[model samples]
Target: MAWLSPAFPVGGFSYSAGMESAVVEGHVGDGDGVEAWLGVLLAHGGLRNDAILLAEAHRVQGEGQSLEEIISLATALASSAERHAETTRLGEAFVKAAAAWPHPVIDVLVGPVPYGVAVGAVAAAHGVDRVDAIAAFLHAQISQYVSVAIRLGVIGQTRGVSILAASEAPILDAASSYARLDLDDLGSATIIADTLSMRHEIQYSRLFQS
Candidate 1:
């Protein structure tokens, strides 16, 4: 459960998924805009990609294979400095956290793996079944994104929780369906997210690393 804690210190608060840039461009100027953006991210972009990656990672770890190749792939396909930085930084942090409270499954995952992969590994270590692990992983992301949304001052705390509550079924459904996916079926192409992350590079008034 430590991994699910918002206080786990993964630097999650630092990124706003280009919300700053969007707001500055007047694309997300109010609470409705923020809610809509959060909804899109939860349904089609952020959570979807992460859920697929983590579920695949869980299935792989559960089968007792090394995650070296997948970890490298996740990082390489990260697409932007902020994206890369977010995954690797959290990967390293997960490693350190795992070391302090060693679990055999997670101990085998001791290196830079993507956040999704590492969480899946740890969930396996803690004896969570595959589907539940993926659900938990997505749940954590929903909470984190909402937390960041709060920091963005785009919505109040109640609104953030409401957004998360509204998203629970979709995220779990995604996890259930996605957890069954094999690597061959594993892919994400959320172009707007990638573009926003790329545009984040040039945004002078940015509130996020990406």
Candidate 2:
């Protein structure tokens, strides 16, 4: 639940991961667009690609699997310089909060533990099973996307929440399937979002950090 709360001090509020660009282009500035974008994320790239990795990381932590491999795979899969900084930033935050739990693996993978791996580790420490842990991670992800979109003025609270509400089943379905996929299958194709992130780099004026 800590990971899902928007109030968590992970600096997640500052980054949009390119939603600003999409908004500027009028492509994602409304409910329909938000639905479409989130649908695409759930149906294709973001959900399966990234959420699966999160699930795997959780399972690894649960089953006494290899931390090295999990971290390596997660790092490789967690692309985007800004997004990487974003995830690592949150991971670092969680590290501080999770100190009392004292997982050696968490200590070792402290700095850039790949968002998924870190989330999984934290979930395990908190005694959440891998599946539920993945659900929380995926829920947080979709919520963040919606939150960023709202910050971009692409949607209002009702629409933003509707977008999240609409995405729940797909996110859960995809996450469940993804949890069973291999790291070799991990990859994202969020072209517009990724490009928007690049565009956010040069956007003359913007409200988001990307």
Candidate 3:
């Protein structure tokens, strides 16, 4: 839980995952919109993609698969430059902090890595259960976006909590579904979210990175 905590220093608070653009476009104007946007993300967008990567990384590490291969695939999966930056920056930070704790598996990762790969590797090295790791990762992603909405004044504190609460079932479902998916099964249908993320790159007066 410490790894996924808001206070973990992953610099996650700086990225809005395209919610800022969505807000500017008026696609997400309130708590309900925030919840709906997150629902789509958790169900079919970056969150789903990350969940699959996390699960596959966890499984591959246990099966003696090459970490380099996983990292390469993950890096390729990033849909945009900002998305790539987000994962790599967060992944690098996570690996640095996790290395201080000295995990034999994670220590072998020499250079930058993707966030999902780093998470799965560290979780496996630390003996965290696959299910728990995926769930926590999804929850952290959801919480980050919700926090973004709150910061944008799209949702109040109580309503943010409520939105998160309402996401519990969907998060579990996505985790469960993604856990059974293989690397080849990876795909995303969140065109709007992806477009917004791309558009965020040139957004003026932006408060978040992406």
Candidate 4:
């Protein structure tokens, strides 16, 4: 819980994972819209792929295996440059803060670990249950997207929390299923989100990183 919390210093608050662009484009303009956007991410987007990566990282660490390939794949799977920067920067920060748990896996993270891999590997080293960790990670991700909506004036705080409340089922569904997935299952279909992230790179009046 602490690892994925808002105050964990991962800077997750500063990046919207392309939701900022979605909001500006009027694709997500209200509470229900935010919820639907999140549903897409949970079911078929970067979030789903991240869960697969996290689960793979958890299994790799639990089995005392190298994370080199996971790290590379996670980086490669990023749909845009800003997306790549967001995951890697947040991952490096997560590894730095997660050092409080004192694990050898933390030491092996030489550079630019993807956020999911960092969280999953460190959680495995600390004996966190795989499904629970993935659930928390997914919850954190969705919460960040909701926060982005709130900050963008698309939804009020009460509506933000309401969306979060409505999101629990999808979060659990993705987490439970994704915890068993392998890298072969890693793929995303959120083309608009990915395209918006690239568009965000050139958006003149951006409020978030990506």
- Predicted model with the maximum lDDT: 4
Q: lDDT of each model, Cα atoms only? A: 0.72, 0.72, 0.88, 0.92
Candidate 4's displacement at residue 85, Å, is 0.3
Cα error, candidate 4, residue 32 (Å): 1.3
Tens digits of per-residue lDDT, candidate 3, 1-210, equal 999999787899999888899999999998889999999888878898899999988988877777888889999888989999999999988888777678677666667689988999888877788888999999999999989999998888999999889998988887788889988888889999999999999998899998
Off by over 4 Å in 1: 104-111
Candidate 1 lDDT, tens digit per residue, 1-210?
677677787777776656666666677766677667766765667566676777767777778888777777777767677777787778778767767666676556665677887887777666788888777777777787677667777778998778878878877787788787766764455676667777888887766785
lDDT of 4 by residue, 53-123 (tens): 99999999999999999999998888899999999999999999988888888789879999999999998
Q: Which structure is stronger by TM-score: 1 or 3?
A: 3
Which of the predicted structures, 1 or 3, would earn the higher lDDT when compared with the native? 3
Q: On lDDT, who's better, 2 or 3?
A: 3
Worst 10 residues of 3 by lDDT: 103-112
| Every model: Cα RMSD to truth | 2.1, 2.1, 1.0, 0.7
Compute the lDDT of residue 152 as modeled in candidate 3: 92
TM-scores of all predicted structures: 0.88, 0.88, 0.97, 0.98
Give me the runs in candidate 4 sitting further than 4 Å from their true place: none
Q: Where is model 3 more than 4 Å wrong at Cα?
A: none
Give the distance in Å from residue 175's predicted Cα in candidate 3 to where it truly belongs: 1.5
Query: Using alpha carbons, what is the TM-score of model 3?
Result: 0.97
Model 4 residue-pair collision total: 2
Residue 39 displacement (Å), model 2: 1.8
Candidate 2 residue lDDT tens string, 1-210: 866577666766777666778888777767898788777766665556667677777777777777778777666655566666666777777666667566676666656776667777778766877777777777887788888887766678988877778777886777667777766776667787766767777789987677
